[model samples]
Every structure is written in structure tokens, then in C-alpha cells.
Target: MTGKRAFVTGVSKGLGAHLASCLAKDGWQVTGVGRRPRESAEVSAAVDYLQADLSSAEVIGGLVAKMDAVPDLVVHNAVTYPDRAAGRPELDTIETTMRVNALAPYELTLDLLAAKPDDQFCSVVVINSESVYHADADSAVYAASKAALRVLTGGLAAACRSTNAAVSTLMLGPLGDANKVEEIRRIAEKRGATPAEITRLFLRRSNPDLVIDDFIDFDACYLSLRYLAELGAVANGMLCRLDGGSAGTLV
Candidate 1:
């Protein structure tokens, strides 16, 4: 499969771009959808980048309509949050974020397979956050959206049972700066609590007890491609963690 077809959303930066490049290197035909296409020579050379406003359902619908075939692999890795702490309307803000995080992915996954309903040609991977567990005061909307996306994952997993395709959920934890630890430290200092007190929050709460892998190395992207590829059609509806452990994990 020199040019195995693959489609990935939110591929302008972060883990999405990394995943796209890894897939390309692994001999897959990569179609990456990004909102604001950037000037990245790496992305330009290896991947076919499509600039589309995924936040708008109509635009997303159009992209879906134009898809050539059911992608052998679909990686849903886009999200928007409510940093609009800047006097934005609450309903619209939440709606837009949820639409990006949850609704759009659900719709896009279905869109990928709709044209060829009988096509059981591959895996659909969803990128989610470890924050899917508990909610902080400031992160209520974000956590809710991810929780809903997980539910969608479960539903889609069930739907794809008879088919040959599979689903993989990569629950990516804090990585690439701008994440937890710091947020927790802020809360700890504000509450006049010790660092241990904040650290305790991550020490396994009842619900998922989701763990965040401390470091994010580039190798995790390659590992994910091989993991999904090795699973073939055996791993529908499975959630895989990308941990940059000292030894690393391989399929």
C-alpha cells in the first residue's frame, strides 16, 4: 500500500501535523484538513493540506461531499475551546467549541464511510484529551465536550462492528506546553495548599482516573501509526494512550 489513503482533521499544527507527517513517511496518502493553512515547508512537501473551516457545518459538509473515497484511515484531531473569556455570548461560544470537538468529528467520521457504506476499508482514529475525566471550575465546557466525544466514539465503535473497519481513540494527555501541572500549581498556590495537594488530584480519582504522560516525544506519532496498522480491523472502538515512557511502547 504505497499510497494508502488517509484523512486527518486539525492538521495545521500540534499533534495533528506530527501524525500527518508520520503517516506520510509510513507510505500513506495523507490529506490533512486545517483551518488556517500555514507556511510550513515540512507540511507542504509531505502532505496534501486542505484549508477548510471545520467550525462551520456547511463547509464541513462540502468537504465531505468532495472526498474521493472512504479513507483507509481517518484521524479526527481538531478542537476549539472557550478562551473567549472575552465577553463572547455563552451559548454561541459553547456551541462552536462543542461543534468542533464533538459534533464535527462525529459527522466527519460518518461522512467518510457514507459514500461507500459497504466499504470496510480501515481505521478511524479520534484524538481526545485526558481531561475527559473530572472538570475544573474553569474547564467545565471543555471537559463536557470531550466527554460527549467519547460517547460518540463508543457509539461509532458499535456501529462499525460488522464492517472490517476499526476505531482508535488516542487519549493524548498534557503535552507541547500550555497544559496542566502549571494550571494545577496555579490552583495550589491560590488555595494556599501544598504542591502535594494539587498533585493529589491526579492520583487516581474514581471516574477514569485518566493519567497524563509527562513527556511528548516525536516517536509516539510513529508508534501510533504502526499500532493502528498492526491492529488491522481487530481494534474497533479502542482507546490507545500515547505515552513517551522511557522505554517507549511498540505494537
Candidate 2:
């Protein structure tokens, strides 16, 4: 992965930020696009930050132009967490969700492929959610969008077969975040235990055959990226589920 170029979306924080940092550490030139401004100096130094909202087609087009040339890797990790308490989602909400989650990535991929030479190798990784399989109270639209993304990835695999570009989708489960850890930590403190203990208990309750314990942090997910990158270097299309053994059999 050394000296490879990667374009990552949603690098403002969380897994996106972590992915950017890990790729940079591996000696890859990373460019991260996010809606928010880059705040951390570490993240800022790890990748070139481009601030743009994915919801607008115009903004996405501008982003495409800025790339100059197609990158070796394109990671669609940016997402909008729906407001579950908003009751039945409005038409606008559903439209925005689809646009940001599925449409933007699809369009950006096409543009990148178009900008590249015929034999250039490119890899696309879409960070999807397990919610597509098990929808929660407020994630109906979100789940649908991810499902569409999965379908899109399949189509892209076929479309890019002769173009030397590989497409992959990673259906992830509950990823750990600072706020989630803090909340769990408070509960663990009340119960006279550590956060790691509570996290293990939670995972055991979630699934007994958990492959990786602890929250799905940057390090855990980074392995998936590496796998995809390696496969993309040779293969055309691949779908992987990384939900800590909760997805059962790979369908």
C-alpha cells in the first residue's frame, strides 16, 4: 500500500478519520472529503481535507474535478445518521438519505472511472451497515439506502469488469465511538467494572461466536480495507460482511 493514492469520504471523525490515519501511516497518500471542517492537526496532516456536502450534485461534481486524476482507491464512508425521533420520515428526509448514502458514491465512482485510462486499476469500498439486514425503529430509510448501495456495488462490479476496477461493500455492525464508550463506561462504573468488561458482556449477549471483541475500532476495520485493497489489485468484485460474526453465513 506504500505510495498508493486513496480518496476517503467522511473523514471528519469516527471510523472515517481512523481509516485516513491508518492509510497514511501505511505510506499512502490520502485525500479525505467531509462536510465538516478539519479540526484535528493529526487528521489534517494525515490527508488533504476537502469540505463539501455530499447531498448536492453540484458539490460532488466540484469534488470530482478537484481530484484531477482518478485515485487507486475510493472509499465511500461518509453517511448521515437519521434522526430516529423525527417520527415517520418525510419525503425530503428519504430523498436526502438516498442521495447522500447511495447516489453520491455511485456518481462519484462513475466519474472517477471516466477520468482514468482504460487499464488503470481502481478499488472502491462502500462502508455499509448491518441495519440493511436488521432495521431498527428509526433506520427504515437508512437501511433501504444501504441495501441500494449493496445492489449498486453489484452492478458496478459487472460494469467495471473490463475496466480493471474492483468494487466491494463492507456491511458493518455496531461500531464503537467515544460517546458510546463514555455511556457504557458510566454504566460499568456503577456496576464496579471496566469499560472493556462491559463491552465484552455486550458482545457476548449480541453474539456468542464473536470473531473480534472490543468495539469495531479503526484498527479492526483497517484490516478489511487492506483486504479489499489487496483483492482489488487483482480481483474484480468482492462483498464482505464485517459484523463480528453476527451476520452468520455470508449470503
Candidate 3:
């Protein structure tokens, strides 16, 4: 093991699960936090699990206080977007969304920073999303929360300039679900076109020269996060976008 500690939130599924597993394989001591236990046995074997609802500051504070080791890397990956089919969200919806998507990271990072030794190194990575740039009717609340997170992360970077703490944000594109590949295959059969042909047309709509999947792949995302984690204090205040395509790997 590298003997480095990594605390990752939202490890129940998707990119969170993949990241936890990847880091564990790379010899980092990983602790995964989620609202519930991980569903995948493989991921469960990769890291210690901590279950806590991120919407509650009290719960997050308690969680942080109970940590036995200072994490070298802290990944704020948990997020929530309320259903907004009925148009503008109610006041409660906004509160809940902000609590989970924005406030949770704020409270968690501050708590971790405060608890760490003055000279100890820590890297804070907030897994922001592209939705923040393209807030449609269905995503206004989520985007607002992410925007708030971006600003707060920048503030944290400044606050840590004289300290050992580092903060960075990874704004990401839509992550491709594995199921989308199969769905595209089915669509290809119906259209009497190869999957590659269909995917090419799909790419053209976004970028004519792009032929790869539109969603950011899990492996690439992991590489980018790993880069920031290893870069440590040098990466402070960095805001990077991983589009899962031509953006390429940071490694």
C-alpha cells in the first residue's frame, strides 16, 4: 500500500464506485462514504465504508470527527438533483438541494481541514458537473447548487493559501452509462446502420470531428482525479473540465 489515505463520498454507484475501486487498486487506503452500503461486492472489498446522509450538517460533522486518520485526498462526489418537472422548485426543494450539493462539501472540507495537523498535506477535490454551465428548466436547482459550490471552493483555495490544504474542482460532462452503449447498439440495428455509424452521427451533432462517446468514461475521470490528488498543493485553485472525449487524460 502507498499508505496514503483517501476519503471518497458517494461511493454507492457510478463514478464514485469506480473511483474508490481504482484508488484502492493503486494502493491508497480508501474510505468510501455513501447514504447506504455499496451494492457491488467488488467495491465493498476495496475500501472501508461510512454511511451518512449528506443533507445533515450535524451528521457530516459527526462523521468527520470520528475519522481515525487524516485523509491525503478528500473527494466530494455526493450530489442530488430534485425532480423539477413542475417548473420552479419550492423553497424546501432549494434548501434540500443546496444542503446536499453545496453545503455538505463546505462543511465536510472545513471540518477535515480543521482536524488535520498544521503541516499535514490534504487535497480537496469537488466533482462538479457540466450541468452548471447548461442550466435548463429541468436542472436550474442543480446548476445553482454547483455554481455555489464552485465559488465556495475558490474561496476555500484562498483560505488555504498559507496552509497545507489544497482545493480543486473538476467540472465534468455527462457521464456515459454503460447501458447507453447497448441502447445505441439496438438503435443501430433498427436503423440498419452499424453502431459506429450511429455514434458518428451523434458525435457530429456536438462536434463534427468527434467520434468517441459523448459521456466521460469512468477510467478517464479516475485518471484526472488521481492527477489532482498526486499534484497536491500545486493543484490548488485549479478548475478543470473532463469531457470524456478530446479533453484527454491529465496523466
Best candidate (score: lDDT):
2
Ranking of all candidate structures by their TM-score, best first: 2, 3, 1
| TM-scores for all predictions | 0.78, 0.91, 0.86
| Best-fitting candidate, scored by TM-score | 2
Across 1-251, the per-residue lDDT of candidate 3 in tens digits comes to 27799999888777788889898888999998888745543365768887778888789879877689889899999888788566778898899899999998988898899899997999999999766665767788898999999899999999889799899998787566567778878999999999878766765675432335555678989989988878868899998777543333432
Pairs in steric clash, model 3:
none
* Model 2, span 1-251: residue lDDT tens: 69989999988888888899889888989999988866743364769888889999899887878975779998999898668787888888899899999999999988898888877798998898877776666677898999888888788878987778888887787789878889989999999998889998988886655666687776778898888888864545676777876666554
Local distance difference test, each candidate: 0.74, 0.83, 0.81
Tens digits of per-residue lDDT, candidate 1, 165-240, equal 7777877654543355567678889999965566555443422333442334446755775687568777787877
The TM-score that candidate 1 achieves is: 0.78
**Candidate 1, which segments miss by more than 4 Å at Cα?**
38-44, 84-89, 117-120, 177-213, 243-251
Instruction: Give the local distance difference test score of model 3.
Output: 0.81
2 or 3, greater by lDDT: 2
Error of 1 at 166 (Å): 1.1
For candidate 2, the TM-score is: 0.91
Cα RMSD to the true fold for all candidates = 6.2, 2.2, 3.6
Please state the error at residue 184 of candidate 3 in Å.
3.5
Per-residue lDDT of 211 in model 1: 44
Off by more than 4 A, model 2: 40-42, 204-213
